[model samples]
Target: MNNGTPHNTTGTMSANVSYYNENFVANSKFAIVKYSDRFFLQACMAFEGVSQYIDFWIPANIPGDGSIIELSLAANGGNLASYSRFPDGVALRARSGRLLMKYDWQTKRMEGNFSFEIQNGSTIVQISDGTFDLTGIVDGVSNSSIYGVGTFTAYSDQLGSFEAQEVSIELKDRSHVGLPNYWQIIGRMEKPEFPHPQRSHIALQVVEHVETKIHTLGNNPDAWASYFQEPDVGIIPAVNGTLEFTTLPNTGHTEGRLDADFRTAENVLIHVSGIFDIKQAKR
Candidate 1:
């Protein structure tokens, strides 16, 4: 049984599936089905030159809208399974794995990053850096029609380089009593890390009639960035850095670059530099 559109529209699913030390940029299809009392979210993908496909099933009752769901066989009323086809046309079921899924109810889209292991007798297939995005689950109309593509990458000496699996950028124009009237750019990057996920943030303010080629970290009050690692390592503020905007903030979109250096409480050096292209959210 299906309430709304059961299958996804064409070109609505984007996914990358990796296993056996090989990566596949697959064409995917997704569906929302109701069986008995539970609603299931299912997806299947097919790659080029291979008879292999990966499938996943999850309960739709789990909380969404920027909430994280850790998938397990006993999760709610549904389980996560992956079927991979081999060269000899033999299919193997994933034995154990970890999956983290995030979704937005208003946008009708889902984002997932997962890694799992499949063992068959003496052979083990390792799946790593697997990611997928499924959109237009309700009416078969893409959410990207209303929202633009946003992506960013952050690199540091301590944490290496990581691309944000999900990115959000917001623009604010406000005037405080004591502070100057300015336009603020706020950005967040969500990185997929098993067990504990990490987030990086960028904040910059541009006051009216402030002319500067580069903004320094300590010298500037309106520019700053931070890294957040919960519990073990708290928020690490930038010690020294520079921020430059290639494309100034506007009502439509903003493009910029940031190079920041941070030092954790334990004296670990983190030199972060990356570029961002984000669309302004509708107000």
Candidate 2:
């Protein structure tokens, strides 16, 4: 989405950390256009003085034959967002980057990893080990399912994606005796306190799946629910169609897909499948 304005596209991007607390999740809309005599992959998220984005207009192009294209911090790129109104913030105004990207025409998907820097004033934010994926791509969608910053998609017909407008990602405990599940990703539309905004309002949680730890949470996928606070829509208690988790086995990460065919109040249903890549945030 451009400036919180929905665009039909997909872009999931995030950084490790920003010195000034940047909070702009790169939405799913990476377009390769010819600007002047070169081709640049224009994928960025900047708005209202909050920016945590990846905009690279390089000499490289995405291969349609399922090959890898490298993009990295080998180059350049901003912001002001405190620990309050935003969950994340940018510390630089101009910067460069390096990355490895790929696009599979057969699958209509794009995947890549990167490391870059954004220098604002005398401060510089060094973001490392960043990655993203784009699916259900079109001319580009802004309001579609943007899990974190990437335009997300439903793995199944029953599942769907959403934008929390305001969300919070907390590394709570899934207390399981000794193996207390370390990741209980709590993403809500509720604006958090000073130090509790979702990934500092910068990194939108990825749409990958975080395997469900039954011992920690529960096995009842139908009862698994999620809802919007303001819109007054929530998951229907007994209306879940499919609920499953594909865990990362021994890692502090997991992937999940759930489709609740019902809601708490209205006939609203909540469907979403994605990854909670909170392992890095906890570090």
Candidate 3:
């Protein structure tokens, strides 16, 4: 797979905090190229030993002559905005805001001003006089991955037990300022020529963890497992499962085990279990 590169540019960001009734200035400001067409902008501000930050995404096709963009939580309306006041461990989504953007064609830079209100339940936080001046804006792809060697074995009620011929893991970090860092681990186990009818391929996603922990699947949005079979069975999703990481990715290695129960459309329950020890490969 072709992994992308992350672009970080220097900038300055500042705002007025309503909760503390103080002017906030960020010590670190940057924009990450999240994709070829999108950028993740962030500003980290610290006040009284507590860290707070504001972030949002912007499209690659921003207007150069200063256009006002609406920031909201609407599904189809505007760009999303997020506010994090740390040690609090909760991120608030903006209910309403505005972003004014100006792109410099000559210097390949971006300048913007914004103000937003984010609310968690009944408590609302207001941010005002927000401004940022970023330089060296370059468009690029955002994520990098390192492949790992591993073994995966599983058993199903409908197809019995099988071992994957090829097992690989991909680690993608999606951390932003003011939020706890987490890695999105993608594990793939495949045996294309396996004799079993529905035991050819399996994929798992483990999201939101930086250390070894037990992750619950099925109704959990952060973790899940899936499998695919040819011809008739499309993709089956796990209804319940548990993924336990004994050792997380560090120093070029990781170890984990998984047990997942997948329910097919035909009402068949498939159980899968596997253990994996992966060594990261040199890129």
Query: Best-fitting candidate, measured by lDDT?
Result: 3
Model 2, 75-174: lDDT tens digits are: 2111111111111322121234566878776676667776665443344566666676754333322332322221222332332234334322334222
All models: lDDT?
0.53, 0.37, 0.59
RMSD of each: 18.9, 18.3, 11.2
Instruction: Please tell me which model should have the higher lDDT, number 2 or number 3.
Output: 3
Lowest summed-lDDT stretch of 10 residues in model 3?
Answer: 1-10
Off by over 4 Å in 2: 1-7, 21-24, 27-52, 60-62, 76-96, 106-108, 135-283
Clashes of each: 0, 65, 0
RMSD in angstroms between candidate 2 and the native structure over all alpha carbons: 18.3
TM-score to true structure, per model:
0.41, 0.34, 0.52
- In candidate 1, which residue ranges exceed 4 Å CA deviation? 1-149, 191-195, 208-213
Q: In model 1, what lDDT does residue 57 have?
A: 54
Error of 1 at 168 (Å): 3.6
